[model samples]
Target: MQFDFSARQLITRLIFWLSVSSFVGYLIGHVWAAMTLVSVSLLIWHYLHLNKLVTWLWNSKSLSPPMAEGGWGRIYDGLYHLIRKHRNKQKALNERIRRFRDGAEALPDAALVLSNDLTILWGNKKAQNLIGIQWPGDVGQRIDNLIRFPEFAKYLEAGNFESPCNVPSPLDAEKQLELRMMAYGSDQVLFLARDISKVHRLEEMRRDFVANVSHELKTPLTVVRGYVEMIQLAENDFSPQWLKAFSTIEGQVSRMDRLVEQLLVLSKVEVNSDVENSDIVNMPEMLGQLIEDSQWLNVDKKHEITFDIAPDIAMLGSDTELKSACSNLLSNAIGYTPENGKIHVSWQYDGERAKFSVTDNGPGIKAVDVARLTERFYRVDKSRSRDTGGSGLGLAIVKHVVSHHHGELVIKSDWGKGSEFSIYFPNEVISSLKN
Candidate 1:
């Protein structure tokens, strides 16, 4: 329903106008009359041509013509405004998407977005680092192909959205991690990975420590009970030699008692509770008391004791606990050292930290055994430890106390030279007590 005018028709109209003007001049005998006829005809032709040009431009498919002047034109202009608005909105949406991608790339934990078919859609920086994935190459790859864990593959196939499944690191892996998968959207899954090896190791250590403690306590109690029963049953028929044996049995019983007491103290310190009810213990005074106690305990052996305490050194801890810890260290030293050998107790402030050290001229620990010396019931010479009435829990208790106070315990010894046990308390504790 459209029409177009040709250039030939426009040329014919010009020729007709010139001819009409010549005819009018011959009839009317006036040049003005001929010019007026020529002007009117040309005006009519130009108006008709203008209409045709406008229709052709509007009907053309290749170019968008300007709107007409009326109600239809207003509607066309409204549509144009709506199209521009949509374009602006789309541009804003794209910008937000770019920003979101940048943020996801910067995250530290390994994060992956998976499609419904268990294919990886996208992965972050940490994912690439942890999983050894190449960016463009990894997208659209099946997750099961990359992870290669049977349990995780089964977990994804199970379609359980309520609970997450853990995927452990692969064998011979560099970084150890635990991956958890959860359904995030209608057709998507989110995979999160975290490093939990340290936590796992800590849990294992706790279990081992508990088992060792139980075993240690059970052995001593069994021995002590057996000796008590023997002494009670043969009391009436006991001679002087039997009486001496009874005294030895009593010594073993006393050693067991000390072991039980130390175990209780260690248990209390390790419990999940605040240890705030402590006193400002004077180190010099406590050392003096320990020396006196050691002298009495070593009366028969006659071991030499030495003290080199720094003046005015103090510590913040339970008076009974600290005294017990120090006493155990000194007692072990006195019990192990040969007669007339030296046992030295010294105190000094290294910078702001306080160091309490006990050095003994005893048979030193072997290089290999030093690592496990602080473990409960771990004795280098089991027979010697039993004979000297050592509970084998002394160093273990010292280690627990030092850890509880956020401190460090260091043991230095050569194969031939004596061992030095140093307990370092944090400087903050000392400064707080001073203030």
Candidate 2:
């Protein structure tokens, strides 16, 4: 057993008592010696009491808590409390992690957390449904082992994270998917996948429709042009009545020509609108050309036309396309307006946008028909449109051109108050004024 008191303390107490006993023995005669012995014994007893108190204070295990109710019962109590708090904190952290996992798993798109070595660490329910994964069984499986596409495997190995890549679905042979990879945390990656089969199908259908229409129109147009040339060459051989018949044929031929032209313009706009070679069209010059073209058309009906142009209001787009769009709008305005009716072509430039409006005093479009006006071959007054040499595709072409250039085409009309067609081009197409 170890003594709590130091050797120096014990020795100091012993020396003090020895000096007291010797002084007492010298002061009294024979009785002094007996009193000195008793005093020495009492000093020894007091020293023992002090030693016991020091030992009790220093030796922690020997003493209990003052109340045993409030203070810690033992040193182990601190350790037990620390352990319990740690367990509670760990349980809370685990619950939070579980909540996060549950939320991630419920997402619609397939999600997979993968390691740098391409092993899948975790996957959501959607991922299992899409990629045929079986819970914990598929956890440690390599991505290549699960997804057996050379293109996807190559993409993963390349490690280029600039943009997402598309891959064929392993679950369905006919379906396609878009796969995107993101660096999530240290040594971990996330793969997100979405189904794009419907989008691909729609795109394919659009291309086919355009191609079919172009081919069908091209054949008819070629035949009509050929017959017109034959009729022109054989004019002398035909009667006066044949000449009138030729005039009718010529009108129809002209309509066909206009149809072909519009079709070509629409096709070109669709293909090249998003490309860089498209030029910045000067709106004033284009509108000037449109005005001149409208006057030529107006000569047949003797309609009154006016222009309210803002100087140097330019837009970035194909010159041909804008001219075609403007000409179509102007022609429609002129066609619907009665003789001597006023038609206004106005242009204005706000700080952020440029707008062109073609207003006419004519039998305006009804509200119910305005929504369908931009559809191909949709005409409010088909007989009037056909008689006025309209191809029923002018508004469709205008809508397509406006949409391609990221512009807005709005039509405001009342039953009899006339119609106003406004086109707004964003500032991205028309930046700053040039002096």
Candidate 3:
């Protein structure tokens, strides 16, 4: 394509110029008839060659370009080079696509390629078996129509791929699958599915074990506390040392009982993830009750407690779970804050979102420890947590409840200042429950 056409053009142009000059010379010498005949013949020959070159370029159907002679050969050579380069580029592109398809096919997870409209464009072998869509027969069929499920369809329509959705397997009865989708190109989607039945089953087993153990331990713990109290009542018969031992026994027993109760609540929350959302919680009523409980707990410390509740900000969620989560935050704040500190409980809607937050004038948590505060048995000051009778599972239970309600638990604090903890519910869940 880069070959210089100027040489060919220059020579042809020079010949034409020479003919015109010769014709003028002859005309001046009074040989006008001879010059006219020579000019006409040259003009006719040039037009014929030009027409032939145009026809070859526009209509020729050959593997190679037309075999041209003279100046036309250069033009033909440039066209041939361009055509070969284009063919090479096409071949390379096709090879890369083939390789990509091969790699995708080798993946263990099922994969689906969909068009802009969610039509089945292509699918791998795993998809054929798991998704139950035949390759050629199902091609161009709507994916939503083929694999219909309310949750899966809503996930597709939502256009938010930040999370994956779990759905029952279309193939096996005892199997479950996690489906994740990603968008590429111009509106095309790629969906992948992985079997998660084993993982799900293991989690269920663990929750069941914890719930059973917690439930069983409650009775013995109550009996132990009862006997310890009975011995304290007969303190006059024993020494002061015996009375002190009874007090320690009673406190440790109560602490252990609280831990067991928290564990049971956490297990129940985890197991009841699929519970129906039929409980409508009255916000002010719940908060007022929590405030009363906090007041009694703070009697010794005499901390300032305040409430900024939106009376009408009620929600449809598990009342038991919500109360537990909210109470844990309040109790944590009360326990951690020093005497004369302030604790504020607020519930309000900020334009598009609603939140219930607890602000405490306590020693702020460390930056590195804040992230893991929600983990079970995690404490910044283990001795202080023990003194406060905290089982260290309160935040863990709060985290589980928040996630179960499709909400987020946010923690914000600065060193030596106070900390604010909030539960921000998902807009979709709130809107749906309101309707």
Candidate 4:
């Protein structure tokens, strides 16, 4: 322990020195010579201690202070305390890092840290087992080089993490992985790979069940609808109440037939990958035909429909699916919009992306309903939907088609005002007539 070097103590030391010099001078018969001798001896003692402190500070690793007396001793002790405090803080920090790494290693999902350049910085053991990222050996390797799937590479380069990509594991043919990338800490990426094989199998089973049942129901539904129509044609053979009942049956059977057909289409689109079959779609011509069909469907409502189609605005996708999606949009607008309501459609490419948008002055959807419009069998107003003859699968089919073509369905609506639905296709899929 070191005590404070107070001014009073310093004054006492000076007085002692003066008295001793005066006594020595009286004996030596030279006062100046005695004082100079005392001063030089004190300077030499301080210099030796200062040298020791400097040497210890510059070269020694020990946290203990150097042995000294007076002011130098206090300084050494202060430095030792500072060094010890810093060491404790550093040790605690190191321990926390160890705990975090241990916890990450115990995770079920494969986790990896990647630099902005997508180089592997660190990975958990699960990453090694699942994606074959070797410990220490694969560090500093480009992640794209390791997971060489073209889709994965594209997804990484796109810088979009709102959705994850599902791909098969490289090591096992049957295993499925859902990979997601997240941005964290100073331009680093947290890449996660989850084993979604069970989930994928279940989804496949659901799709297969829907597809098989829809196929089986299609024939029976057709037969029922035909018999109902035949009974409706012979209206005089039945009483007025029976005829009304038969008409209701006919309408319901028709709606059921539409629902079954949509289910089949939806299942088909879901089963096929985004790029399963590729072709250049003549979007302008397709929209023109759909507009004509919408006009026929709009005869009763008399909605004022118009379109501005860019001449050569084509895209690379499945033509049948695209047409179906476009038809759904137009049909919905005609069915829902009030009489004489304005519906405008446009197709344009702004170099970066191609867009198809439909704007309508319909009974606009509420904010809460807009988000779930694409879900199968979702209805904002069930009574209104039923009156309009909607099967509640149109928007769902549209969403799947857009997603299958690597596009997005963007819906914007203002309650009691109007709504706009747009599909945006990235430039990679944007094509043109090769004239």
Candidate 5:
């Protein structure tokens, strides 16, 4: 339709030029002069068409493409159709982007789109509320400048997103926020912030509740144990049956007392969120003490126990926690091994981390129960565990202790062969003693 105007104008101009040329020829009485004027006018029309094409090419952002007639018209029309297709595609893409942003805005957690340079590009409404971002007002501002959290900046630069970092929520001091980053789309990063304040508070409540109950039961347990021991000491005052009953009572009470003490220690370990004054642990000395305790524990079974300990192995953590973890593993080995069976304990450093392992030639645990071995009250052989006076919280206590020290507990076993329980303290928590 646009080219039709060019066509009509061309035809009108050609006719007008021919009539003028004819008039000039008539006035001059020369046919050659009129023919030359007509040719020049035709050449002028071609120049105007070429100029329009050049202008269209130069101003590529123009709303509409230029139009022409004759040979140039086909070229212009082809380019115009191509531009229309491109514009349609662009419109569809823009719509999809808009929909994606709307979906992101609806998310509950704060979400931010950041440039490779850590500049704030875009963010959702929740992000605005949480991070106090004013959208377009802070568009080009550096994200670190706004958040000012040292750990977050460190994590961003570290580029190790395997774990998230926790920090206080920007909106409320009481709230805790977990922040993680996902890298995408040409060096850009997607940051997500979740409020974990509720979870934090619940964990705190659980710790406090466990601690309070353990503390309350301790005094009564001590009195009961004292009376039970006194009764055992008194002889020839009752029938043999009554003495046997008293013995059972004494054993049961002692078991309960031990459980209570462990519960108290476990609660204390759980409640401590950070380490304090923990760098003075003597690993070799600690292992030696554990060997002595294992020997005493195996006196009834008379099992053969061995220790291969590495010297200069020290770690930074609560001494009580370390002792509990190592002692529990050794106790499990000594309890399960048959009389005269061999048990081996090793303390070694493998460059990256220090490992404390207890391996025994006892009845191997089933594969089904291996995963839950660390769970409180879980037992592969419940009857055997009870017969051996296991309170069923040893492994659970060990797990908490290891985790408190930022270490790992790994269990390996082959059916009918043996079980090996190992604690690996990461290098971050391990250092050599000065001596």
Candidate 6:
């Protein structure tokens, strides 16, 4: 059995051996020689144990402690226990890592770990199946080099991950993939790619259905409206109640016509994913014409309309789409604001960006409603919206237009106070400027 060899016990044992050796030497008249022999023997014993310990540390595969007595045995036992604990902990840690890797591999979406510099550090099999990222070979390559789409490259370079980038698959043109990036560990990014071909196809089908239905309804609506107008021309022959009924019918027909027209416009914008940026748009001229039209529409409301348009502000965009977007905003302000309310419109280009804003002192929208303002058919007050003849497609059209031009639509409003609708165009779209 090995006893714990404390320093005190070892010292006591040495003292006893020395005393016994000295006693023998004194009897034989060789005390110094006996003591030297004892010391040398003790030194040799310690040297042998020290060599055994060094060998165990360097090359021993077994956890069993080397046999010894007293202090050396105790030291061996201590080392064996320490190494065993460390090995067990390491084994548990490795098991956890294996489980995590297995879970990641089983995910349906393609997942990749990337360094800050966008180097592909690791990816699962789905990455290969979805985006053609081969394992082992592509691990050290930069992700941008593998996915060469201009939109995808620009999105990665911009470092903005708030919105996912939707692009056609590089491997197959018919397939669609939505790519998202998120911050992972320090200075690392987690990239995810999902197959969204079905979702994309469904969206396209919906747009096509809306466009076709709107086209079909147009002829019938025109015929009905023409007949209603013809009947109104003979109001003198009808009774008072009949005349009033005919008037209501005409108003409803007009509202329906407006709704169908707006739907066609929205579908057209949605179908065209990219805009033609070749045509230069004169912001000052376009907004000036819209303000005039707005004043004419506001004759009944008598809202104090004002505009501050900067001259010669130009950008590359579709003139027709820009006019539709600007017209909607101005007309919305005139329609929604209370009578005698103040409306202000401004167009400004400060070299970096150009902005068009319409501010109105009307019944401002609530905080919750502001977020859903751009949703088609969403209205803060449904009954009031009907009275104002709002088809609820105006803001939706404006949003799509701004997105198509790679711009932002910002709406700021406070309940019971006022609201401002602003569209900002990035400097890249600005084609010319004059002070």
Q: Among these predicted structures, which one has the highest TM-score?
A: 6
Model 5, range 1-435, lDDT digits (tens) per residue?
433446777678777778788888988897678868788878997898888878887866685767666667776887788878898999999999999988998898999889888788888888877767767888999888888787788777767798898788777888888888888697898988888889989978987887789789889878987887788788678788988998888888877778888777777776764566457688899989888867778889988888899888888888888888899899889998888888999999867999999999988988898999887677888889888878778898898888677778999999899999999988878878765
Question: How would you encode candidate 4's per-residue C-alpha lDDT over 316-342 as one tens digit per residue?
Answer: 889989998989888888889998899
Compare candidates 3 and 5 on lDDT and give the better one. Answer: 3
Which whole-number lDDT from 0 to 100 does residue 228 have in model 4?
86
Estimate candidate 5's alpha-carbon lDDT, on a 0 to 1 scale: 0.83
Which is the winner by lDDT between candidate 5 and candidate 6?
6
Candidate 6 local lDDT, 94-128, one digit each (tens): 99989977998999899999999899999889999
Model 6: how far is 98 from its true place, Å? 2.6
Q: Which stretches of candidate 2 lie over 4 Å from their true place?
A: 1-209, 212-223, 229-236, 273-278
**Cα lDDT of model 1 by residue, 137-214, tens digit:** 799898888888776776667565455554566543534577777777898988877766677668557755764785
lDDT of 2 at 337: 86
Candidate 3 least-lDDT 10 residues:
426-435
> What are the lDDT figures for the candidates, one per model?
0.73, 0.77, 0.84, 0.87, 0.83, 0.90
User: RMSD to the native, candidate 4?
Assistant: 3.8
Q: For residues 1-435, could you state the per-residue lDDT of candidate 3 as single tens digits?
A: 456667678778767766676777677874555556666776886677678667766887764765667666776787788778998999999999999889988998889888888899888888877778777788989988877888799788878789998888877857888898888677789989888889989978988998999999999999999999889988889999889888988988888998999999989887776646667778678888888877889999999988898877777688899999999999999999999999899988866677999999899998999999998789989999978888889999899888778788999988789999999976555532233
TM-score per candidate: 0.49, 0.55, 0.81, 0.84, 0.80, 0.90
> Of the candidates numbered 2 and 3, which has the greater lDDT value?
3
Which pairs clash inside model 1? none
**Best lDDT among the predictions, by candidate number:** 6
For residue 399, give model 4's deviation from the true position in Å.
1.6
Relative to the true structure, candidate 6 reaches a TM of 0.90
Candidate closer to the true structure by lDDT (higher is better), 1 or 5: 5
lDDT of 2 by residue, 1-435 (tens): 222446687678666766766676667655467556867687676666556445545674533322222122332344445656787999999999899789988777889889988789988888877777756789899977988887687677767777566677888977888888898898999888888889877866785576568768877877877887788788898898988887888788778777767766665665564534246667777788778866777886787777888877777777777787888898899888888788999989855888889998888999999999988778888899888877778888898788767788999998998999999988777743477
Off by over 4 Å in 3: 6-68, 115-117, 133-137, 426-435
